[model samples]
Target: MANIKIVLADTDDKYLMPLERKFIDGLEDKADLIVITDPDYLKEYFSEPQRVDILIINEELYDAELERHNIASVFILTEQELLNNNTGDAEANRIYKYTSVKEIYAEIIGKSSARSETLNTKEETKILMMYSPIGGIGKTTVSAALCEALAKYQKKVLLIGIDSLQTIGSVIPQLPFMESGTEKLLIEKSEYVYEAVKTKIINRTFDLLPPFHLSLPSLNIKGEDYINLINGIRDSKDYDYVIVDGATGFTEDLSRLMGVADHTIILAGQDKNAVYKLDCLLRNIDCSDNDRFVFVCNKYRNNRENFLANGYMTNFCRVSEYIELWTENSASEEGVLTNNRSIQKLALMFI
Candidate 1:
């Protein structure tokens, strides 16, 4: 578990005093704050590689220092200032832009309900599924990144790898496991689904459930069987998020998982085949009215513009905001996730 690092940049010492105190008071032991007014030291702060989670910047200092640093930042202003500027439009997701010191405290505590839920009520682990039809995109990457993000505020998050072949490189940088298999659980056929479902939980929160032997050509599981397994985990009242890294294409198992999912995120690569597959999958899915769904475009390039112009999406999830982060000059060379900075920023976006 890493501590929440915050950078506070303001020119006035009087304004900076209360903001620093409020931040420390809000998060207590959970956060660390660095106050800076010198523009020269801005590069020095970010150059250390210890990515700051949130940057609380005054409106006056925002434009000068905001030169595309790798961090999740929020403009710190007075309540009157936020309303005057109408800063809420800049907020990408569930995060709220705070106007006052008190509001900042509320944002930190409000979003962090997973810990409080355990103390007050029987916590129910909500399962989230990240699924898509095509491969070589960012389904697996998004799943892993979402897990990393959710783990920021919530202490308990499990990223399960249930794809057919096996998922090895997504969560963290690692050497391939020679015999990663979910076959043992299949063979056990236990009435206790927990025993079967729970395996290889790494980092602080993520749990990895290995797939059947990768060497094998095919792997299959019934739709009902997957639902039962997920239900058993949900019944435990332990984790906050049960994120499923699904297999490519629409399978019975995938449908079962998606059907039960509270929120589903579909990743579409900027490719013609991927678009076609996404269209077919959306048409086939029998989703309920209340289910939350979203579309994320990965490896975005000129093809994305073409896809949007063609009006690709047919049903479910909004495609208004396409997420494209990885750049070609990145270390991965394949335009996939290669750096921790992008990974950390992505983690914050989902969190």
Candidate 2:
């Protein structure tokens, strides 16, 4: 068995001290252990990358920084019975309070062993581009929903909005203004692009790189710049999925973005004009077997003609995987598509 490097972090003095002692005693000469009780020290420790084999942290202390480092095995310690009741998956490891040291040891060793076996098989980050030629097709809504759903499943996701109009701000209000400006960061050559992206991340769920805050008539971003930006994000290894919400319409920049993506999700509607536009867009782009493409019919209504329209879409699009997102009135009112069960289920399939 490989020796593990473990970090036990918790805030409760009464609970943390005894648990630390027990862990040290149980794993003595078998592993390297570090105990952290102070919040400031814990934050400082995670500021940079640390080779932590296993992280046993309080549920309340879990943050985006932990997720960013790509810790392979994480076990959240909680006192709530409800939280501890659902801990089966590799990502959802949890330990209830007052558990015996032997039980804790078994859980840690089991998860750590599994982590070691697959350490060399880490999957490359997936870049998914969400685009539509037709406007008002709810592309942004679907993009945001996909990010949120992936995050909920413990997958780190980054949302990049390439639309010059900056519609993401309308959905997610009070977005922090980029002091350096998104345009400046992308256009200028810099070695710290990855670090710069880390600082702009919001709520630990996903990072948003919107268009220039200043209202310029048009952005000067070119196709190559967009490619470089996406490449930098992929190389950073900070996110499991990078979702680019491109502007509506088929442009050189959009085509290039799709070329770099591992998967492209094309959004369309049931209307004849939308279908015609989609067919035209498909003809322009060269989507081969290597690049996966999924067709989604947004705002779908249950009717005989609309159902046949979905069948017609497959004939021209040449994509086997097709999904329909029915119009949900509450999706707008809630301001979050994942709140709707159907949307959530659909989003989960993307990952």
Candidate 3:
């Protein structure tokens, strides 16, 4: 528990004493309760805004005093204020108001815990999506290998393979897993997507939700569906990160995937055709003008040295990172390319 410094703003010492006691009792030693007996004390503390994480206000301070002070603060409100006022919008990420002391404590504690968890790590939960053109270019291999490398950090990770391709079973067979199926969580209808995913989550070092046994390719997913799903998972209080293994090439779904991604790693290999398609895909993107699309040269051999050196293609695509790994089965638990140091550098693009 973090020691939270709080400022209580209310009139009348008799009423203030019980509320202060209730707030302190409700917090359970998680806060250093500082009761401001006088409005002057509120002014004194407001001068040093750094001291308080939360402020409790009564009916008395709602009007001109609140406007005059104009302190940017998290607020705790009485039951009447919470029941009466419906002005606050959920869209705006500010001025969280709690009705009771217990509710206030929970919100502060939960937020504080989340902040602490983020501070303790170099890599936190990242919602990442991998895309490419044509399946032979090793999107599955890259996704699986990346998941393996992510698992090495001992953080909870989730890998969800969008059911555009039905061959995910053949991709990674080493682990005991299940499919969320295109039936439950369609990329078009964002409703109940998380619940569908939650059921199919194969709990392990990294949980995977592969495609279902049945075919449902006609599911026309929209841009909004992808947006909602990505936002839901990103805002989800659980898991350190999310990895989306999407189909090769640009569809509405893929465009939505790239749009919400913190970083998109495009996998390229020795095949000239695959590299050309990847180049076209990278060039066509409208997201970040900066280095958002990381070009990863995967599964390159000695024969592909000239391919990496091709200055025109490199300059056109702005190829930033390269991962040259020997062609192995790359699906087996121990045989996969997660141990390779070069791929670790590529993984840093998401980290």
Candidate 4:
């Protein structure tokens, strides 16, 4: 709200005026608001590639190339939440059109705060995502242990699961999961969401935000939804870490998580097929080939990986001893292994 620049673009002033009115609080100023309803003028507006913090555009006027501009987030107005376009894909955001002005403005303000880190610290929230090229490779187990280590280190952490099959309840069966009925925290207002989220967060060793309970719901989730959900949680408190237990395989959602994560931990098994899969995964991946990512072989009885496509495995696995903890009864909240051999390095990464 302090330094955000907002642009509302559409073909009708009837809609623009009211929407602009919502943000024009004369007290301290929410943001720098610019409204343009003319298509030709809108074209000229972006003809020079201006810097806009938030761009709210109609679906017809939207393009996939706008992301190249100096924009932090783009909210595309759509008639339906799900798009029927088979050729094009969803952008950073897709806000349902014809919703109440209050709801739409709420989205803009919420996402804006997420982009600007509005009521939180100056340091951006560190999003650490956990992904695996192969399934059943103890991705969630490592995630739980890492989370506990971070918690024990006195870091405010939030672990979110998107495994669709629901492994959270199985892994940490003793701890009570914070329950909620909201669909990815997309309520009417950000203020309400911040307060509601703080209440709904389950705390034991660390905070846990329950993933969508719907079957295969992650498939329908857009990158923007993930961004909003993460930012909304961060807005509740200045979290030191937000660990995402992502799904297996290569998906748009997983790819987006990998791209956005401050540190992405990829888990693989200890075998030839594991090496081949991990090799091919790094070979064709579109994510940044930087130190932000690391590959670990789970269930390491011995050093079996020669290298992935990038060169060498980041490390041997977290150790096969944790395999016994994969049972439904072992990952009990009190039984989580906080004092691990390698996870302490992860805990020190933030320090």
Task: Identify the runs in model 3 with alpha carbons over 4 angstroms from their true place.
Answer: 1-125, 174-182, 185-192, 218-226, 286-290, 327-331
lDDT of each: 0.58, 0.69, 0.58, 0.65
True lDDT of residue 28, candidate 2:
72
Top-lDDT candidate index: 2
Q: lDDT score, residue 95, model 1?
A: 23
The TM-score obtained by model 3 is 0.58
Worst 10 residues of 3 by lDDT: 89-98
The sequence of per-residue lDDT tens digits that candidate 4 reaches over residues 1-351 is: 366678898887787777778777521354687898888888787778788878889989886666667887688888775532222443366777775665566556544554565422344678888887887777887887888867654467888887766667666765553354555454344445555566667786888866445544543545546566677766655687898988878777678767778778777665667777776677767434445766555566533433332345444222212122234454445545544545545455543
State every prediction's TM-score relative to the real structure: 0.58, 0.62, 0.58, 0.54
Model 1 C-alpha lDDT per residue in residues 1-351, reported as the tens digit of each score: 556667777666676687688767656776677898876676576555545566666554454344455455454543242213345535311323333445444444434333333222344677788877887776776676666545544446776666666654543455235244554455344668666556544453355554444532354455555566677778876777788787787766677677788777777755677677777776887543433665666666753354633663533445533556554354343223433433444344333
lDDT of 4: 0.65
* Candidate 3 accuracy as lDDT: 0.58
Clashes of 1: 1
| Stretches of candidate 4 exceeding 4 Å from the true structure | 1-123, 175-180, 187-195, 216-223, 235-237, 286-290, 303-335
lDDT tens string, model 2, 90-191? 465777766655456545654465456522234578999898888888888788877876666556688887776777766666676555566666566466
Off by over 4 Å in 2: 1-122, 180-182, 215-219, 288-291, 307-312, 318-329, 332-334, 339-350
Candidate 4 scores a C-alpha RMSD against the true structure in Å of 19.8
